[model samples]
Target: MDAITQNLDLFWNGFLRSLTICLWGGVGSLVLGTFIATCRVAPVAPLRTFGTAWVTVIRNCPLSVLLFMFAFGLPEIGINAEYYYFGLAALIIYTSAFVCEGLRAGINSVSAGQAEAARAIGLTFTQTLTQIVLPQAFRTSIPPVGSVIIAMFKNSAVVGAFGVGLDLYSVGESLTSAQGFAALPVLTGVAIGYLMITLPAGVGLGVLERKVAIAR
Candidate 1:
């Protein structure tokens, strides 16, 4: 209580920063992941290979390594940016692989006959995917996609460790190390801050899942 009250501004700013990262990262990952999933299931052999390689390499790589590369290595090639953007990029890139896999599973659940029918009727691959397959695939994939997003939100804590910004983890670190506060209270506050974001998101996803199920 004392630690949090004394440093309200720090906590507030940290909370906002974490939220911002999650928001941008979530949208970026979903869009990129969807495109990758589409490519993975496309008629073109080269696209399928590219998508496969992307998911394979990225899924095998550690998130921390990606963050290190983005945070430190990018500057060597003169593609410098703020640490915040670098961290967000890492988060999106890392999470998008998982998102791609989840969506690909959903896309696979769609029947092959439907795609064959669409082609027989002169529907292009793009039309077949966007109009028929992806809509159903998204519905089928809500739960897994929601889980990925939740994990990404929690993972955002690591960003501050790479000096991305003064996020919740950094706030706790500052209070405990620099400000001489007890670690317990400072960490508790930080956990609560994360819960504030994740809890509502989890509940909202639950409601969405139920609604989607009902619609089906």
Candidate 2:
């Protein structure tokens, strides 16, 4: 209790930073991933190839490695930015590949007949997908997308390793080192802090999933 009271600022800032990362990261990845997924399923062979290469390369690369490059290597190439932004960028890029795959799976789940019907009705490929396919695909995709977002929430901790002060892990370490705080208590608070954020998010996503399922 004493330890927690003393470091209230750290814990609060950490929680806000984590929430920021998760929100921005989820949004960024979803948009980019959706585009990539479209490319993967596009009529053009070149677009499909490009999307395949992107997913293959980015998905196969380790998240830590991506973070390291964004945190340390980007500065070397003269793309320096704020530490927080760099960390966010890393999370966005790394998680986008997974998002792409999940969306692609949903896109694939859409029936071929639907696409044919759209075409028969004089819809272009783009119109067919945007209007008829993606809507249904998103419903099927809610579960996997929620899972990806949850994973991204947890993975946001990795930024702390790079000394990003806004991160919960970094804040907890700072308190322990500077204040001689008890590690267990500080860590427990951190765990609970994460739960506070993730639990509601999970519940909300679950509700959305159920609603989408019922609508289907």
Candidate 3:
């Protein structure tokens, strides 16, 4: 109790930074991933090829490598931004691959007969995808997409490695060293803090999944 009261400000700062990263990263990834998934399944050969290559390459890369690339490598190429934005970009780009795959799997789960029927009605590729496929894909995608968002929220801690001064990992380190708190207690607090974000997200996604569940 005493320790928590003393560290409330640190905890609050960490929480806010983490939330910012997750919020932007989650939205960016979802939008990009959906686009990539659509392209991957597109009728056009070139679009499908490009999407396959992107998912294959990005999905295989280690996330830490991607973050380090954005953090240190970008400035060498004359694309500089605040370290925080670089971290946010890394989270979005890396997580977007997983998001792409999750959505692709959901899109695949959609019945082929439905797509055929849509096409039979003279629907173009975009129309069939948007009007018929993506809605169902999104609903079927809830569990995996939820997992990706939760993973992104936790991954925001990695930004601290690049000297983002106020992220959860940095704040936790500050508490242990500067404030003289023991490591275990500080780490435990950090873990609980992450759970406070992720657990609710999981529960809420579960409810949404149930509500929109596709009839098998």
* Runs with alpha carbons beyond 4 Å of true place in candidate 1: 113-131, 214-216
Clashes of 1: 0
Residue 141 C-alpha lDDT in model 2: 88
Q: Which ten residues in a row have the lowest lDDT in candidate 3?
A: 159-168
List the candidates ranked by lDDT, beginning with the highest.
1, 3, 2
Which lDDT tens digits does candidate 3 get at residues 82-155?
98888888888888889989988888899999999999999999999899988998788888988999999988
Model 2 whole-model lDDT (C-alpha atoms)? 0.86
Query: Could you tell me every candidate's TM-score relative to the true structure?
Result: 0.89, 0.89, 0.90
Q: After TM-score superposition, what is the CA distance of residue 82 in candidate 3 from its true location, in Å?
A: 1.9
- Scored by lDDT, model 1 comes in at 0.90
Could you give candidate 1's per-residue lDDT for residues 1-216 as a string of tens digits? Answer: 899889889999999988888889999999999899889988999999999999999999999999999978999999989988999999999999999999988878888887899899999989997988778888879988999999998999988877775888889988898889999989999999999988998999999888876243
Clashes of 2: 0
Error of 3 at 22 (Å): 0.3
